[model samples]
Target: MSSPRGGTARTAPPGRNPAPQPAPPPGPNPEPDSTGLVPYPAEVAARYRAAGLWRGHSLPAELMAAARAHGDRTALITPEVRWSYAELSATAERFAAGLLARTRLRPGDAVMFQMGNVAETVVTYLGCLLAGIRPVCTLPQHGTREVAVLARHLGARGLVLQADFGRGQLPEQARALLAEGVIEEAVVVRGEVFGKAVGYGELLRAGTGNDPGTLPYHSRPPEGVAVFQLSGGTTGLPKIAPRQHEEYAYNGALWGRTLGWGEGTVVLYPLPIMHNAGVSLALQPALLSGAALVLAPSADIGTLLDLIERTRPQVLPLVPPALAIRLLEEPRSHRTDLSCLTDFIVGGQKLPLEVAERLRDELGIAVRQKFGMAEGMFLLTPSGAGEWIRHHTVGTPLSPLDEIRILRPGTEDEVPDGEIGELCVRGPYTIRGYYRAERHNASAFTLDGFYRTGDLARRHRLGGAPCYSIDGRIKDVINRGVEKIHADEVEDLVMRHPDVAHVALVAMPDPVLGERACAYLVMEPGRAPLTVATLGAFLLGEGLARYKLPERVESVDALPLSNVGKVSKKELRQDIETKLAAETV
Candidate 1:
C-alpha cells in the first residue's frame, strides 16, 4: 500500500542506503516550496556533483548516446512493432516534436499517462522526457478517486490513456477530471475517438522537426524532474514522486552494471511500463546497456511464456509470486524454452525465499530479489553474487552513494545491526520530498533528511557484502490494543504449511481491542479449511507469542492484488469489516 507520506501507518516512499552523506548541503531550496517540487539541499547537491554522481545527463541524452553507439542494434520489440536503436531514437524525437506541434502542452507541464505494457507507453514516456514534459505515470488500475486527486493536485496538462483499459472507466474519469479543470486535454491510444481525444499514433506522425536529436531547451537540465511515479505500492491514494533526470539516470545505469547487463542483454518486461520498477529498473537500464526490451502484450502467464519462448530474452525482470504460481502450474511453462534467461528479478512485494528457491531449483534459472520504490531507492541481488545472497536477502543498494539506517520505529536512533527496525534511507536516486504535498513531507522525512521507510528490516552479511532482509512493512502489523503482530511473520509461518498455497494476515477491527489478526488463506485443491485454533496451535508450536496468533481464519481461491500487483490489504481489510458488519446485523 502507501507509506503514509504523513502518518496513516501504511507507507514506504522509495529506496535508499550507503554511508551517510555529509549533512544535507544548504544550497538548494533553503525551505520546502508550495509547488511540491522539493529541491535537494544545496550542500547535498554539491557533494553528489563533486562525487561524480550527478552527471549532467538526461534520459533523452542517454537515448541519443545509445543511438550513436548502437545504431543498427534492435532496441525495442513488441507484438505490434519493433524498432532498432536508431529508429527508436528517431521515433522518440518525432513523438517529442509532435507533442510540441499538436498539443498545447508546454515544457515543465505534467502529462498524466495511464497505459499498459504496450510500446505506446514507452514511446510516450520517452517522448515526454524529450519534449520537456513531466510524465505522471498513473496505473491502468487507478479509478476515479486516484485520477481525480492526482490530476487536480498535479495540475496535469494532459491525460494519455489506453483505449482498451477499464471498460469505459478511464474515459469517463478523464472527462470528469477535465470538467473539474484538473486536466486540459485527453489523448487516447487504440480506443474510439471521443470528445477532444487525440489518437496516439496520429500525434507521433505530426512531427516535422529537421533535427530532432538536438537537445531543445538548452540540453534540458540534468537535475530536472524526469517523471512522476506513484510512491510506494498500489494500496493507497496516489502520491507522486518527482524523480530527477541525472540521479534517475545513474540508478538505471547502476542496475545494468549490478546485474551484469551488457550489449547482448535482452529484457522482457511484463509489468506496466508506467511503473517505477518498469521504467527505472528495466526499460532505462536495458536501453543504456544496449539491450533489447521486449514488451509483452499482457501479463498473462501463457502469453508471456509464448513470448519468452520466441524471444529468448537474457533477463526477465520482476516475477510476482502469484504469477510464479501460475507459471509453475501452466502447462506451457514446463516446455517453454527459457534457457536463455539468466536472471528473474522479483519484486513488487516481498517475495518469499521459497519462490526464489523454486525459480532456481524447479525452473533452472537465477533469482534476483529486488526491493524498488517509486521515490527512487532500488535494491537488487547482483548478477555474480551467487544464489546465497539472492536467496538470503534482496541484495545491496544499487548506488554505493545510497545511505540506510535501521532505526527503531518512529525514531532516528539506530537499532542493533541484526535487530529489526524501520528502514530509513536517503540516496542520490531517492526523492528529497514528494511533489506538492508539503504537509505530508514534515512526517515523511526525518530532520536530517532520511526518508522513514515504514518497512521493517535488519542488516545481515551475505558473503562479504552487506545486505538487508525485509521483515514486512510496519503498516502490515495487526494491532491488538497494546500489542502488535507482524502480518508477514504470521504469513511466513502459515506459508510453510503443507496445505497452504498462499496466505495473507491482516488486521480486523475489534470493538474492544481495536484490531485483531485475521489470516486469509489460499489452499491447494481439496484441502480442508484452516481453523483459527489450528493456525494458533501451529503458530504457538513455531514459538510465536499467543498475541501474534490469528484470531480469525478466512479462505479464498486467491488473494486479491492491486492494480500494480501488490496483495491488496485494503480489500482484505474491507472484507473483514463487511463480514463483521453483517454479523452485527
Candidate 2:
C-alpha cells in the first residue's frame, strides 16, 4: 500500500523531521465578537501552537512563498488558461488591490463565491485571501434563493460569479440582489455584464499601476478567519464553519506531505473547487507543496480520462464514488494510460468493497478511502494498511494530535471498540463552533468542546494503530455523491405544496450515487397523486438546488411513527429498502 513514490502512509514522510512546536505568541488572543466567529479557547490555542500544529502564517503568505520558490513553474491549468506560480501570485495581488479600490469592500469584508472550476475561481479566491477578505465558498449550482440566504446570513457585501454558468441565470440573480441592496457589488466573470455589475477583467485592470506591497495584505492576523466553509446541516440551510489561516494551511500541508506531493507532482482535480475538499485536498496542498494543479471544468468520465491522458497527472485526490463508477463503465477508462497516476482517493461517500476490488483487480488502481468534513477532522486509509483495513475502514486520523471519541448516540458514554457510536472530535484543525450558530452549537458541541460529528463509526486495531470504519449516520441527511441532501430541508419545502398533506424524505439505495432522496407523501385525500417530475419542477422553482430534489416519489397512506408519535424515518428507510429489493428480484 505504498505510494507510487514508495512513501509510507505515515503522518510525515520518512526522513522529514516533525515541525517543532513553539510557545504561544506574545499577545492577547483576538476575541471572536467582531466577526461572530467562535475562536478556540486561549489554553487550547496555546497547546496547538506549542505542538506545532498551528503555524503562525496566513494562507496568502504561504502562496507568496511558493511563488518565490517555484516562480516559473506552472501553478494552475484549465481548458482555456494556464498560469505560472509567479503569474498567479501577481494576478492575485492585482485583483486584491482592485477589489479594495473599485468596490465598497474592505479588508475584513466577506464575499460570496459562486463560480465554476475555472482559472478566475482560483484567482478570485486567492485575491480575497490576500486582501484579508473572507470568501464564503458557495457552489455554482446554487440559485438566487440559496445565495440570498447564505449571503444575508454572512452579511456579505460582494458576490463573485461566473456569468455564463448553467443557463446563464447568475447575472440576473446578481442584478436582482444588487437592486434589492442585498449585496453592494457584483463582479461578473466571462459573460455579458449589464446593470451596475463590474466585469472581472475591468476589476483586474483597475490595479494595473498600483503597487501590491502598498496594500493591507497582512492587516489581519493569521489566527483570524480566512474563509467560511458551509456545513451540511440537517436542521436548515448549511451552517458556516470559519476556517482560520494557520490551521487551514496545516490541513493542506499535512495532506500534501501524506500523499508524497512535491515539485514534480501534478494533481488533477475535477470536483467543485469551492468545496472544502477542493480547497484543502487539492488547491491548498498543491500550492503549498509547489505542485502543479490541473483543473477540470467537467466531471464527465470521458473528459476526465482525456485530461489524464494529456496531463499524465500523478494524483487524482478527490474522486467521489459516482465518478469512480462512471469511470469503470466508460470504455476509454480501461484503454487510457493511467500509468502516471499514483494515488486515487475516493471520498464524499463510502466506497463499496465490490467497487474497490473491481478498481484494484481490473484497473490496477489502489484506491484510498477518505472521510472528511468542513468542520475539520480528516481520516484516510493508510498506504500500508491491510486489504480489510483499506477497503472496510476509512483509516486513522491525518494528524497525530487529532483526538477521537466514540460516544453513545444520545449520551456521552463511550462505546466498545467494535460497536458503532457517534463520532466526536476536537483537534487543532477542527473548529470549536460554527460561525454565529449559538443555538445549534449548544447541541453540536459538548460542554467540554468536542464537535459531535453526526456520523456513526466503529474503531478497530490495524497494525497496532486504531483505525475507524463508518457504519451509518445519526443525522437525517442523505449522501448523494458529494452533495448532501438534508431530509428536513426538503420535507419542509414539500409541505409547502398545495396538494401535499404530509411528507417524509428518506435515503434510498442507488448503485451509482450511493444514495438518492425518496419522498413518501400523504397527499390531500381528494387530490391527484404527485409525480417525481412535477415535484422536482416545483422544488426547483422554489429555488432549491437541483441536486436536493427528490428522485423518487411515493404516496403513502400515512407515515410510520415511533412509540412517541415522532415520524419514524428508520421505518421509512426499511420500507423503501424492502420495496427496492423486491423490485430487483
Candidate 3:
C-alpha cells in the first residue's frame, strides 16, 4: 500500500516485523477469536469453559441494558453532541442496520476503526459490534504503514475513518487501502465522500430506513472475540490481543462497581477512546453504570480545564503525568472551580508520590493509581481506600477470579511477597494468545496460560487492603506519556543509517513526557557522525512517525555488554539517567 503522503511502504526492521501469518478465510457464523484461537487442551478447555465465565453478549447489549435502566440519563457528551441512553441505543441499532445494508461485510470479517473520540466513532463502533463484525481498534495517529500492515494482518474487510482529525491525510490513508484492494468497504465519518466509499451520514440515514423492529440483534455465545486490542510490545510490531465478550463485559461491570460508579456519575475522558484504557476502563464502565462520558477535546491543560469548568465532571481519568502536574500548577487552575472533581484515575505509568500528594492536599482531588494492560487484567486503587493505599499502589484485581503471580525474572517460580518480580497474570479478561501469532504467543504466555506482562511489580498491603505497586519495567520499551516506543524498533531504524556502525536506543528521563528516546551510536569507520536533526529527518523520510523519533543522539565508542555478551540496556539506561541528572544540576 503506497502512501500518497509520500515514501514507499515502511520496511519494519527485524524486531518490528510481525509474524507472516494471517487469519483463516472469512466464514459464516464464525467464532471471532477462533480464527487464530490458541487451543487449551480440549479436555482442559471444556472443563474450564464449563465454568461458564464468558457471557458472549454483544457490546450494544451492555449499553441497551443501561438504556433500559436509565433511558433519559445522559450517556455520551462531546463539544458538539449529547446522547441520552435511549437515543444512543437507538442510534447504534440504526447504524448497525445501515452497516448491514451498505456493506457486504459478513460476520467475523475484520473491520478496522481509525477515528478520534467523537460521537460518530461510538455509533459506528457499536454498529460494528451489533453487526457481528469484529472491530479492530487503532489510534488515529497511525499512518499508512501502520494502518495498512494491521489491516492486512487482521484480514480487515473494511475500514471506518474520519476526515477531519486535523492530522495526517485520512482520505489518502483510506485511498491507499482501497487502491491496494485491502478493504472492500469504506465508511468515512464526518466528511463528504463522492466515491464508492459510504458517507457517515448516509450510513445513519440508511439505518433509519431499516426497520429497527425487524433488525437482527441477540446475545452472542460466550468465549468469542469481541474486539482486538493492540499490544505495545517490547520487541516487535503491535500484536493483536483478542478479548472475549463475556469476560470483557465482566471486566467493565466489576471495575465500575469497584470504583463505586453507577448511574448519575459524570466522567471526563481524555485518552484515546479506541485504546484499551479508554474503551475497557473508561467508556465501557461509564456506559455500564449509566454515567455521562464527556470526552476532552485534547490532552492540553487548557482544553481539559475548560471542559471541567463547563461540564463539572465528577470523575476524571488522565494518562499523561504532565497533565496532572500542569493542572495543579497552571494559573487558570487556581481560578477554575474544581470542587466537582471527586477522583482522578492516573493509568499509564506510576504517578510520583509527591504529585499525587499535591493533587490531594492542594487540589482536593483524590488520586487513584491505575495499572492495566491490553491483554486483559486491570489493577486500580478503589475510591475510598486509605491515603497511602490509594496513592501508592494499584489495588487488587477487579475480578476475584483474576490470578497474579510475582515470579522471579525469567523463571516461573513464585517470589516472596514484598519482593519485586516479573508480573505474570491469567484471568477471565486476559488473553491466552495473540491473534495468529503462534511463536509470539509461545513466548508471551506460560504453558499453563499466564501472560508474562513485562512489568516489575510487588505485592503489598496498605491499611489492610491487598494491593500491588509497580516498581519498574523489565521490557525494553519507552513510555513517553502513554505512547510506548519499542527500543528495538527505534534501534533497527537507526541501524539503517550509513553514519552508524552500532546503534542502541534507550529511554531518557524527562519532566514532561516521562521518557524521551535517545540514540547512542558507534560511528562506522571513516563515516561521519550523525546529529539528532539528520537522524530525525532520515527516520521521517523512512516513514517512521514523528512521535517515535529519537530526541537526542550521542557518539559512543562501544555499548556496554551484559555478562552473556549481549548489549546491556540496563547499563545504557543508567548512563543516560546519570547524564540527564548532571545536565539538570
Per-prediction TM-score, please? 0.92, 0.79, 0.75
lDDT value for model 3: 0.73
Model 3, residue 527: displacement in angstroms? 38
Ranking by lDDT: 2, 1, 3
Model 1 TM-score (2 dp) = 0.92
RMSD of each: 5.0, 11.5, 14.3
Per-residue error for 131 in candidate 2, Å, reads 1.4
Error of 2 at 51 (Å): 2.2
Off by over 4 Å in 3: 1-34, 39-56, 213-219, 233-237, 462-465, 476-585
lDDT of 1 by residue, 209-251 (tens): 5467453633788877878888754334446788888888877
The models' CA-based lDDT, in order, is 0.77, 0.81, 0.73
Q: What's the CA error at residue 550 for candidate 2, in Å?
A: 18
Candidate 1, residue 353: Cα displacement in angstroms equals: 3.1
Candidate 2, residues 205-242: lDDT per residue as tens digits? 99777887776656568888889998863226458899
Better of 1 and 3 by lDDT: 1
* lDDT, model 3, position 114: 80
